[model samples]
Target: MEITSVLIYIIVLFLSTIFSYPFLKKLKWNSKSIPYKLPPGSMGWPYIGETLQLYSQDPNIFFATKQRRYGEIFKSHILGCPCVMLASPEATKFVLATHSELFKPTYPKSKEKMIGPSAIFFHQGNYHSLLRKLVQNCLSPGSLQKLVPDIEAIAISALQSWAGGDVINTFHEMKKFSFDVGILSVFGRLDKKHRENLKENYCIVDKGYNSFPTNIPGTTYHRALLARKRLSQIVNDIIYEREEKKILEKDLLGHFLNFKDEKGQVLSKDQISDNIIGVLFAAQDTTASVLTWTLKYLHDDQKLLEAVKAEQKAIYEENEGGKRPLTWAQTRNMPFTHRVILESLRMASIISFTFREAVVDVEYNGYLIPKGWKVLPLFRNIHHNPELFTDPQDFDPSRFEVAPKPNTFMPFGNGVHACPGNELAKMELLILIHHLVTKFRWEVVGSQSGIQYGPFPIPQNGLPARFWNESNNT
Candidate 1:
């Protein structure tokens, strides 16, 4: 009787173990798979989510404070969306370069409507590739070489206009200069009347770009929409004229007009018009802002300004004291001036951050970034990192004498969506600075210390300043 009872107990124990083995295995696997937690930091209040806090203070301070407290990657809600801010170079590259397919560029719908939805920056895949190729082709090195003389002419004209001893808003004047250069690239010497029309309507659109997005009559945004329609009409008129004349030149518009896909599908008028306006929009503000900052920096640091002038003056003398147009080779060879531009880009960090939306739940550094959340690579945070840059706050062009780490210096951003117009922008800056420093001197007027953001940070009151022709003084 004892042996039979022992046998029954052993069989029961064996059957129980067999039944529980699969359950135990599954539990272990589940624990490993679900271990990730959301990153650190405050999401602010429930609905508005720190939008007020962000706008209420200097944006750089807000970001820098957060970085100090919460480390490189942190969670916050802004503009009514949950976001994970990536301040480290590795994280930035992961989102923007390595795993870019997992994230898509995101912008406010109002901005898309303002800039037109078909713009290259708003897209990915084949459509974006097509537009980017066309843009790159027109702005290529060879093409830019051809544009040097024209850009020089525009730069000379701009400096002359600003040299009348008026306390002009430097940022505003720079905007006009950049707009003309933008026009030259897009249309290649557009007629004065069409240029004026585009400028008038574009200014209205610019005013409403950051305004509240409401279609109610008389609102800034509403007026902007009307202006946008008129701009489209103007672009269409130009297209018609080009077609009628059979004008085929190597400009942005020419590239657009000449494009035909393997399917023989050419870009539509809306595509062309939207892109033209988009290029103008892209070309104008950021370049103007950077140029404004360059002036402010140079004005504040006279020693550095003199150094830049010395470099440019040598080149100027070579060109017979500005009698000859600047050559592409001369522009390319301005090493010190190039470093100054690099330092300025780093110091200003004009494109502070860019927005990307996660298309899937992503795991990074053992943190869970849930799908449908916004991910912003804080370019400003990276640019201002003390570890990455020694004395990051101090304006030092010499730091750029050695190249920045792979992804650490992204003033123009990085990865596939990097600015195609960056070279042209650099060329514009080089030409403008060469002329301004060699042929002109300027004095900053008013309080020279505060910053204001007209959507882009500019010195307070647009760095009110007077410029004088040094040649005239001589």
Candidate 2:
């Protein structure tokens, strides 16, 4: 009996060794790879960790709860990796500017795959700088001045379409408007069918950027991949056509075709296609989110709405009976309109936080952000902090009359990685609001609700509203 028991124990031990070796090996590798002091906080559950709460919960609540217990900088596992969340302005500046080289841009695997390797966010150092310069040339002040007329035309047409409607989804309309702006301003003019097709593919791709990474047939990620393939094919066809026709146009695509890098090497067909996708990703939905929030905020405040209307009315009155589309000077000169956009962005906090991963294990304020761990510069936390903005939850555009304290109002981000499209986005919003308030007015259909914070800010129920042309006064 004793001999039989000994054999059973040996068999059990041998089976456990075979089953556990791989996991143990990985565990050992992780420990050795990040053998440095970690910041203070919990890692939560074993595998999934704090990702669900950090991403799925109300951002203010999540950060507040964590901050209460763990203080300003805390360590946790989120978005499938270990992360150190930096909630203070100093920390934000450190990662975004001061020691930015130690932390490179990183996104969820799903986002990286969807945006592609050629996207600016995927590059670092010199390559990123060069790509940014190329993109900046396309969206430069000179280019924007030329593009304003087209933008105003699109905004006017979209508002006209919204006329005579009882209830419309403000978010959906803004999305369509922004998408059309991308099609025209980035790719130049296209036939309606081609434009619609591109919009459809982009919408599909946008839906899955923050989705699970699984590629099963029925998954959002799978659909996103398919949509991306279709989008690539469309872009490639345009590139070929432009090349064959020797089209020397002035839009973004034209700039790409003519762009010669420091080595005198222009972007290849695939590179151009990927970067265009990046432009659309950066420009469209994020602008839509801010626009929707602007509508919601304006509709809720009649006094503020009238003030905004007056500003636009003056601009229109200057245009000799509003006959000409808005000029770049007109758009740039709307101080109140600009302030309102800034306030809406601050209130909505469209981009909750941005992620950067440590390329080398580094120490900040005595806390260690280990190599490969993500560092979250908490934008929303800073935007909503009462210390930063008085009555932070109040919808007040006037607060932006004075410039926000440095590092405290970074809706478009700050430092080296600041969004190249920031000026263009602001111009788009200013133009859209100018048209909306001057030509049309909208009222909320039902009770206005709070915003939902995912990767973007979504107004509850898409902010359904009844629209009226100012002439009709209905």
Candidate 3:
């Protein structure tokens, strides 16, 4: 067993190094246009580029090394492609907003691999517009208000399960709650049995997102393949069940069933399922990660905690004796709570690098970017830039207490493809964190006590927290 484990480790490491070694040639590319611009960064030798630094988990090292060498906005390679690093607000806005049409993400595998090709996250052109329209319509403030009771119920029940003041993995807890909330909002309860089946089916696609490229037995990819099938089956069955009964509920799945395209061809059941799974992937995982870091920051900073608590207490008491649970109004009223979540998002975003495909040569800041060059905008670099954000390393919610600090903050991303579920995710984080701070307190353990990342980046430590009732705080 020991030998086998060592061999797997050696093989994975060997392949990783080989994967990165080819890009050294690209290092010779000239990028003198924005030599003295943007936040500092680098693209290392060959194909490895900045990704090797990304794999290092400590992102600051990438900037620390790059800032010391390349300054910023220089040519570099990442994910095995030669790309330019753009960080300033003007450059970023140009890519995400001004010339967004020219730089849409058309990568086949990016949509198919990270998120399924058909999922809303990867959809482009008219299809992207359609999916965004559906999501936006469904997630409108009026609809979200109705989801309050549903969200509150799930949150309360989850919190109740943390009975023993136990050392809880806040990250996993958040993921589970988020998954439940997202599923319910998207599909409705329908029935207890149907909901259970849908949840089971959901995991198949979820697992696929993280699987290796290979889809063979004994591989995580294989499990993901099976999971995707199961997830699809569950959604299909729900659609079939609803169709058979001539019943339509207001849930996301039902909404899709009733949707019509420009040509008026009804969306098929699989299409609906695929979009839900896609949105779920975007909403659940990212929100869970943000919440995990929010807890970490709240636990580490006592003043922030007290401030959040004070705000929450006032909000909770204002709606005193109301039996339907804290309404959406109550949740949004917690100013400090929202600020902390926003700050955490700025500090640690699950999506740090955004990929864009260039359709034509674009000129900016005196540099002509050739057509077809992959655009890689460093999301983290701008957000944590000390020049834009004071004492960037520190977790201070007050920085965002007013408005976002311009180019330095784009957590859900920016412009056209920015997460449509941004409002929903923010609401969930604020609501959940509000409940956690009032009900319990927590602390980190071990070297990994703080935040960490994996692949798309998640809290490496799972954000361990010691939970307790408000009585303990007293």
Candidate 4:
């Protein structure tokens, strides 16, 4: 009772006034020593922090509203931490593209709550660099090309199997599809029981994404904590087995298990397991949601539907591999499909806001972001700005089809720690959609608005649509 009282009180106070606002000014903090300034936005009502205000219904409206009031750079308390919201193209480029070193991923939770401490995502400095190098080698362009067929195969299976009665929750199927694909991509083939365990454990870990910092019964965090242990054990066993056999395979786990930095120091099983799960979490949910929204938008927009299907038909016809699947070389030619997916990413901006925290006191745009204070780019602000895009809300792919108009788009984020599997994820989704659209005609069959983002929200209202073989549909 006492602890809860203190936490709520602190959160309240933190929201009402910047906890260190007065202090920041008193220190005569001049980070003018820095190169770029932060873009501006507003802080939130007292206790709730800027968290709610920034994401308040249709996040774009709030960002636009704030930018109007605050201009190009502003400060706010978000998620109980003081943060500087940067939105201008110049500011965003500094934070994301140029001065990436000054800021890095500040996901709300720690490794204990998210992955584990040794995971690649949680490592800083040399460890993160080393891990990234090793992992990159695993998913190198050539390596990724090899996995395309497998990823597409999994996607197709889910779509066909789940669409039982001309009605189905595509989001649900997409989630399952990504989960299975991620598992296969990372750990390779698995028995049904093992697959179920992986999914259930991942669910627990995912629940932790927004869970409070508590282990008490009935709390999502508690369940996630339990799941973490189970996952660690399963991964540890696999790592050891792989190590013992000295076998090599195409999966992410195999790559991690066998990796060594140039110094030749090998990664430990714990590190491998931690990084594996961390990467899987990063890959699966977001990509799945991307696929979900892509299907929704393409089907609803007639011109877009024809454009997408036409592209798919060409890919299928030209594919030396046929529907047997595509190599990255072949998939790369479908520019229209890529444009649609990129536009979907811009519109959905699934990762509405990516976060970072100051490890040292920093000054930008005449404001001080003190050590440990959180920061959010509000990527969607840049993604949806009318100045940056045409009819920002409209489903237009041509915006990205030709040369990108500068900082107008950054769906997978930018700079270091940006999604690495972008090419692989893109190929899998496009090919899946390509096969589905070319193979069957379909339509959304439910309340469009309700099918929105939850966490990694996708078309969840069950995108039921009448499907028929091409012969019947034509």
Candidate 5:
């Protein structure tokens, strides 16, 4: 009996060894295949992560500290998600442009709900491609050329309103101006009534966008969700009117309306409304924030402001003291002012970083980016990196005279998800700056040294300032 038991044990041991050999070999092969390590940095505490640490101080300081300690790429947990922050231009390009497929655009679920899930910002693949083409067509150079006179008119009107010298929040005023242009781009020559309705409802939605995402009644977020519904309805009303009148136009709404897929699919009304709101949301705050920073920067540097004024003044004189509408050629010719806008975009870096999610385990520069982790390309860090830009802290528009190194300057971002309306936004800036520098003088009011984030950094108190028409001053 003892011999039989010993024989059974020996046989079992031999069989186990034979079966486990392939498994052990496969494990060893996998280990050898993946030799990369996670990028160095703290993940903070579990669940809560480093969210408090991030929000407690200047986000720039937080990121700068991490980059200094851990080099360009580092790991941290923020807002309950483990993330990899990439501060190098090469890593940014790899994630945003080259290996874009390996990382997908990501936003908070609340944000997605507020912006609408079908908006091009939240999409990938064929749907995103289709929407992008339609938007590009709407804002094409041909379209923007026609828009110059109208945009000039908007700028003139905005300046005229601000000339009374009541200390107005520059950023708020810019919001109104950009929102109007956004409306024009979406709906060509919309009635004042419709425009007012859209603006009023959109303001509510905007207010709630960054509020805590609570659905309880009477909450700001709840109010925003309700206002979002009204916005959709307003868009639908416009669509219905167009269909009834059979009005075919060349605005963004027209493009969405006219699009037909190879499968003969017409976009749903909800889809149309979603994209329109998305465009407005994209166009308003960003353009306003940059314009506000431009105002502050120009105000702070009299010499630089004088130089930009000289450039625009030349065009203003050529146009016969603003009697003639700005020609597209004239708008294109303001090189100095254009550089100021570019530099403002770089210095402000309003979109400090962008969020993407790793779709699969990605090996980048000998580091392992595990699947499902959030990846942030720190645009502000890259833009401010002294190595990338000499004395990045100073506001020097001339640095842009020489083109930045490849993948180094992405004010409007890069790759498939880059801002489609970048040209339009720049055109708006040129027109506004031309009118502003040539016809108006302004001083930034109150303390000018602090920054505030209404989700985007603007000068403290919205750069409170007073404006005077040049003619009025004279």
Candidate 6:
């Protein structure tokens, strides 16, 4: 553990890996090809690379500093891999859409291990296509329509509970609300106590998502692995219970159970558990962040709040005095509210970036994207670019009245790897907004503060806010 010994060990490891590179390449499963003409950028210090800067510094500043020096598209080793970061819509499109086949999906080792190999995010070719199709079918418009009443019920209950609490943490509350909705929508309405236990285990799993992949005892990743095992057990138990009782429920789990791919192969129990976890993992944080920031933005601007409230109020009246569950028709009619959601997503950039690995050496704007190197579509930079949006720093929902140029606003991401659950996430937000704006009055309790970005930007104060049922507003 001495410094000199540590340095010697690192040096030996580094050299041994380099010496064994050819042998590693010939492993049949090793997908890496010889990297050639890698884009201009620094690989940083040894194995650590530029990862420290990415995690330690503010993401905006880190990206901006690099962009200023290296131009829109530049190379930098980050997060344990050498990555070519793209900032422009054109480059984003090329990597995410145009030549998407040339760039396969890649994610952190921790994410890959935790989310499982069958999860859609890390998949490609026929397998990824099958998973995507299955997910789309489960979350289709008609399916969502059937599920909306339950979603509304959950939202109403959550908001009602929030109404009675004092000085609530808005982000935490929203996460719990969304997480609960995810559980119900995916697994059908199960026992409340079991659902709560599942939520607790999921929390541990979520925390380990961005942690180092090391499985050493007492590490976050170690805890996450354990939690993942427990969650798998819980899911398997539910599946077995449903089968034993001869219950066939119409929910995501049921859809997955009955789903057969082109190969006519049904998902195994482990595949089912892994994909379910992947669904929860994808929807939970981003949805919660969007909900929290939307409310926070609305709270900061009274005029905007009134405008949003008016929009919701119109929908409320249209639904026969707000007594009905939000149908798909009603959700589609809330154009202004949709614009607000889009604007909030533009500003918040809940998912800052996503990774893709070059399947082959690719050329872009005369630069070489060497095969096997990771490519990052910098969603945050693209969303915030002045060229893409005038006065990009300001929050203006009206801008969405007319869409920006194609691929200019990818909050959920772009191309085949784009989030499949975005509509569901949007529906969850829309429902929460409809209820919140129509039935509640809320305000921040203290002076507004900046957001602290850790994996995602969260209000530094946890967005402490006071709330009252709208009836008590006067």
Give the total clashing residue pairs for model 6: 0
Model 1: weakest 10-residue lDDT segment is: 22-31
What local lDDT does model 4 show for residue 48? 49
- Give one digit per residue, the lDDT tens place, for model 5 in 172-287: 99999999999999998899999999999999999999876779999989999999999999999999999999999999999999999999999999999999999999999999
lDDT of 1 by residue, 353-449 (tens): 9999888878999898877788999999999999999999999989988888999999888898999999999999999999999989999998989
lDDT of 3 at 200: 72
TM-score per model over all chains: 0.92, 0.90, 0.87, 0.86, 0.92, 0.89
Judge candidate 5 at residue 229 and give its lDDT: 97
Candidate 2 whole-model C-alpha lDDT, 0 to 1: 0.81
Error of 4 at 119 (Å): 2.2
Encode model 4's per-residue lDDT on 1-474: one tens digit a residue.
134644554554444345445544443334566554544555466544566554444455666677778876677665556567678777777777777677766654444456877776655578887777766776788887777777777866765675544576676667778777778778777667777887888887886765446568877778888888898888776666666878687678776766677788887877877788887887777887888788789777888889888877777777652545676776788888888988999888888767777666766756666666666677788887888787888989888757766665777777677777777678777778877887666667767664344555455454555455554534
Show pairs that collide, candidate 1: none
lDDT of 5: 0.89
| Clashing residue pairs in candidate 2 (N, C-alpha, C atoms within 3 angstroms) | none
What is the lDDT for 45 in model 6? 67
Report the C-alpha displacement of residue 33, candidate 1, in angstroms.
9.0
lDDT of 4 at 417: 71
Candidate 1 segments whose C-alpha is farther than 4 A from its true place? 1-34
Q: Which regions in candidate 5 have their CA more than 4 angstroms from the true location?
A: 1-34
Better of 2 and 5 by TM-score: 5
Model 6, global lDDT: 0.82
Sorted on TM-score, best first, the list reads 5, 1, 2, 6, 3, 4
Backbone clashes for every candidate come to 0, 0, 9, 9, 0, 0
